[model samples]
Target: MSSVRRAVSAPAARLGLVRALVGGYTLVYLARRRKMLRKVVRTDPAMFAPVGPVRALRRPVPAPVADALNDATLVSTALFTLGAGHRLIGPLHSALLSWTLSYRNSWSMIFHTDNALVVHTLVLGASRAADAVSADALLARGPQPAAHPRYHWPLRLMNASTTAVYLLSGVSKVARADGWSWATGDSLRRQVAIDGVRKEVFGSHAAPTAYALYRHKALFTLFAVGSLILELGAPLSLLGRRFGRLWAVSWFGMHWGIRAIMGIKFRYQMSGVAFAAWFDVERLLELARRTR
Candidate 1:
């Protein structure tokens, strides 16, 4: 519990409080999922769309990114439930993911966004593990296919691609809102009052204290400017040099602040896994002993 709090800072406590609310939603959602399956089996008339189209069945085999992400989260959840790597990320591993997000399916070729994030994180871990084993005389085995999805390369590419999505999200908000009217406190207050979206997902309006301040025009402008900085400067976190540390830490603070202030948790906040390009844990472990 302490580790969760320390790792995530003060927001962890709020997360703890809000978690059951989220869980309750998930529970109801699962109930609905079961209800849907029952309807599908029973051939319910309501299943038909107004235009006379029937929804498709579930996909067989991996849908590339979606299945891969499912697999990754499954393993992560198992490990977390067993208490290993539990501190690094909390129940985030088990959080219900929106695998059917339209944007992921809008494109025909590239993997879905959820899958992209998880697969990239896994590939990052795989490469580090391989680097660590390479220096071993006996433990280092031949090609690890599980670690290498392409089935050949012992070391995978570490792309650290989440920053792009982060920036894109900021950009998306601006584009959708017809420029950064979010710069104004009034806009933010109205957005916060949105019923189903916030109530169903986050349970409440950030922290009560922060919400009050969110009504201030000056503070809203400050937040808007800070968000712009975060979005524009996101790429800095990908740098491998000392500057990356500064950039990543700054983003970390910003993310936690957002969570604490708006009850909005960025799914990719501690996505250090996505920053594989910047750092490699397995390599660090291998190098820590001064081995080749």
Candidate 2:
């Protein structure tokens, strides 16, 4: 327990930066998706197979109720981001977002885009993320701890969660029949072609670049091997900050490469939220201020 506490303990300032980044990102993300979420209210209630807390409801919520919940979430999220009443607002925001997203997915297809992010939000809300650089900090009359376990533990947990996702994906590849063949076989090219076909048939266009490379089995084989290595080696981030950044970059490349070739986007990963742990956000903020 002591070791665990030590590992997660972080400076209040660092936690403050994390709170700002994660909270701010979530706010912007919510705003950007307001239209899509609004559609959920208008979606057929017959389609709502309740999940999470909403499962307790015997019936789908009225559109007005849904809209009210959505608005409440946005407001709570803004308060959480601004560091006002974060201890209360943080968890409220996380819960509201989770409920909203789960409700949305329940009404339709399960979208994995926000899974990691939502997990991060819950962890952040439960931690001492608002202890520094926050309204709470300014309002406190007593001296705060220089560092606290609650501050950094959330970041570590978030990092582990994100890494596990990649690691499992890598394990899945090799866990299948002749998984090793992914590297030596034409699995990569075939998958790309299939993705292209699927997209084209669905009224979307496949990446022409992917089609051009489909004939080159050798290059595709290399790509396959690289992807496997990246996913399997995700735990490298647990070793140190430098390793974390390296893994983050490789992961970023993996997401971008797949999108470029398959036209499938992992918005959260591409947005840099998954790799927040590896960055010195305080330093970056200082640099931005100086440059401005």
**Root-mean-square deviation of each candidate, in angstroms?**
12.9, 2.8
Q: Which stretches of candidate 1 lie over 4 Å from their true place?
A: 1-116, 125-129, 133-138, 141-160, 184-186, 195-206, 236-240, 271-277, 280-292
Candidate 2 has its poorest 10 consecutive residues by lDDT at 141-150
Model 2 reaches what TM-score against the true structure?
Answer: 0.89
Local accuracy of candidate 1 as per-residue lDDT tens digits, 1-292: 7654333222211222122222233333334444333333334333323210112423322345444544454454343323333334233444323332221233233333344344443332332222212222124344432222221121113234556666776777678645766655455556655632466576543466564664476776777777777776677655444666666666767767766666665544443333333333344544667964
- Over 159-208, each residue of candidate 2 has an lDDT whose tens digit, in order, gives 88888888898898889997678777487787888888898899989898
Each candidate's lDDT (Cα)?
0.42, 0.81
Instruction: In model 2, state the lDDT of residue 255.
Output: 89
